[model samples]
Target: MSARTTLRARWQRLAEPTLVRRSVVSVLLAFVLVWGVLLCYIFMTYKHTITNDPGLQKYGDALLVSLQDVTNPAHAAAAIDSTETWTYIRRRQIGIFPGKTLHALSDADGNPVFASHELKTLNLPPRHPEAVGVITEAIAEGTVYRIYTGHNARWALQVFEPKRTDAAFLAYNGRFILPYLLLAMPFVLVPVWLSVRNGLKPLQQLASRIARRNNDDLQPVGFDAQHRELKPLEQSLDTLLARMRQKVERERAFVQDAAHEIRTPLAVITAQAHVMARSQSEAERTQAQAHLEQAIARTSHLAQQLLDLAALDEAQRPTPRDLDVAQWLRAALAQAAPRAMARQIELSLDAPDSLTTRLDLPALESVVHNLLDNAVRYSLAGGTVAVGLRVDDGGTTLQLAVQDDGPGIPAAEQGKVFERFYRGPGHAASSGSHNDAGHATNGSGLGLAIVRQAALRMGGQVRLGQGLGGRGVGFFVEIPLAARRG
Candidate 1:
């Protein structure tokens, strides 16, 4: 293959949907979504917990105690400035400390005594001291702060840090969280991939078993599926195999029967040819020629019947078209008129002036021709052969019946008449006899089989019954009108 073709094939394979790919993708998406939700939950919880840091209150209390011991205003200011400088230096040196803190000292009258550099420009208000340190939120110049207040008898001290924004927190902490999440993914995905592969192992094995089977091995698969999901697949495969086996058996039987039926005519033709070649007089040659012709005719008829049966078996459902069935029946009778006349059999049709319906024309033609041929072949000379077509079952079904005044099949043999190449007990002797027209009355024993199969193909059925005057045989074919009507 060309490079482009190979690439295209690969792309198509990837594009095709597969169960394993779908399952793995679904699991991966769920994993990512769950991880995202967990991250959000952790961020919210940590934000709430850090807002009331206990260590901030302790720092505030210590600052207040230092301020109480300094009575001089300059010394008090110096003490506050010293504390702020120390906090700044420690924050810069230690990674664990807050990134920024602002401090302010106030007297008992709530006047600001001193303020750190960052807080100096802003107006600072003192909070009322509580017995226990209290943490609260305050907003100054559009910046939110988490504030802790502490007080002694003389001085109240305030220390606060700017509350971290969501974006700031993410930037600061994402590096640590993201690496760990990345590290954990392979651990999770490896197990998931293994589980999915193992889960589908049974399906793969089933496919391998099917692939290993030979074409002639139409037996049901023997694999004992352990999974609930695999049972339906196994059953369906077995059912298909069973059907195939039946079809193979039927084909084998048909071939055997066809060979057996053709052999007799072939042998007769061979013998007659030998006789003609060896004949010394014109009469002997003529007799041999006649016999040869008869064998050829029988062989041709049998071949045609075989072809008709095979067509019925192999052809797909035919498309239906509007057909005047009554008119069609008359035409069929006209075509069969020569054979009927030669046998001195009177052919009659009983149908409406105009009966139109949708039908599969070829199937209908096969049915009518086979029935007429069978009737004419079996009916005695001077016998009446009748053809009938009518809409019955309140116009829902079309009934076609052909009857002949000849020897009818016995009740015991009637059921077997439709079998392929099956002739009655005395049919062989009768088949060799000639009619008044010097034409052999041989029957291929396939006419009724063809009729039955053709009727079935048209969604109809054929049944044998009493003929005209109740003395001979009749074939009644009933087809559903509703099924084929346009």
Candidate 2:
């Protein structure tokens, strides 16, 4: 492919769900996290202003005291007009009061002091008899007070700050700060964003390096992340790559080993066939033919095992369906019947009248066939091999078992039996007959391995032990009933 095409493909791969999910989650979390911190800072400033304003509190208190002295007319008027308190009052008034008008209650005659505009709007009784009661109670309660009222209503104290001035102050601040803020934002955002992007540069480089790799290249990821925070992530990715590389190497080795094993039998068969054709004596020809047949059988068995391994390696999940366990067990018995008869071994079925299970057809077939073959192949001639199928625990468990009169495996070696290519200790002694003529040895090991893989794929387990009816090996499989489907 062209370089441009390869680059495009790499970009597409980077758009995979894993990368997209990580990027979106990181950005969203960062936004919420930063905004949350800023909001907390603003809340702290608000609390400090309201709580620590001693000067403002004192002014409010003095205003309340003045409002309480209503009996002395001269003192009340002087208090109302007192220039000594004007600085305190104006500033406090500007800070606390938002409306265009406020009210002052005189202690002398219960009169009100207000602006001219307020007076024109509110022509009330000499004493604002309506406010006298409310203001008296409010002052007595010592609440740093504010009241909301219309222009036509009489109030205790009235102060007005021009709306134009308030608007101008806000507009002036906004105008003065806007250019600088606009200019500073790029500086702030650019550096932080660049720093963040730069910090993430190693990740991008690592991705690019990974992208450049061929399908067969599962080598460790190569990148020197500069930041401490990125090191752990790089290390994890490196570990993952190492594991993947090791798995690929193991699979390659297995394929090579299988090919070598198969090739030997095929070469022997070819040689034996050539010898049979050239043999002049009937006896020699017959022996050569027999050897050729054995070699062909071994080759065929090896081929079958390779195919089974390939099938078992497929990652696709099986489509499970409910099946009658008794019926399936009967079928499994029928499959084993031929091998049993060849050895004159009696095969018997002990399935209940009706039982059901959830299973994938092909996978379940492999499981049954392998277990039955293992049982019949290992059993002594004239031995009885019994198959059983039943439901237990209100149909939650569908159990299938096959038992044969053969030497059982040791308990300690049971775990190792499931491993690929693992041959039991007494496999040679257990073979019982050289009539094993046209069959496989390695095939036995592969059969059990395939059985385990299939059982696990169907969310089930298989176990080996002494038979329920005999002192020989019993192969049993269990699948959860819930997986069953109509």
Highest lDDT against the true fold, candidate: 1
**Which portions of model 2 miss their true places by more than 4 Å?**
1-118, 121-128, 135-253, 272-297, 391-398, 407-419, 422-430, 433-444, 467-471, 480-486
The digit string of per-residue lDDT tens for model 1 on 367-413 reads 89888877777677788889998888588889999987776677877
* Per-model TM values vs. the true structure: 0.64, 0.59
TM-score quality measure for candidate 2: 0.59
Q: Provide the lDDT at 427 for model 2.
A: 52
Best by the TM-score measure: 1
- What are the clash counts of all predictions, listed in order? 0, 12
RMSD of 2: 8.7
Where does candidate 1 clash, by residue pair? none
For every candidate structure, what is the RMSD over all alpha carbons to the true structure, in angstroms? 7.8, 8.7
> What's the lDDT for all of these models?
0.78, 0.62
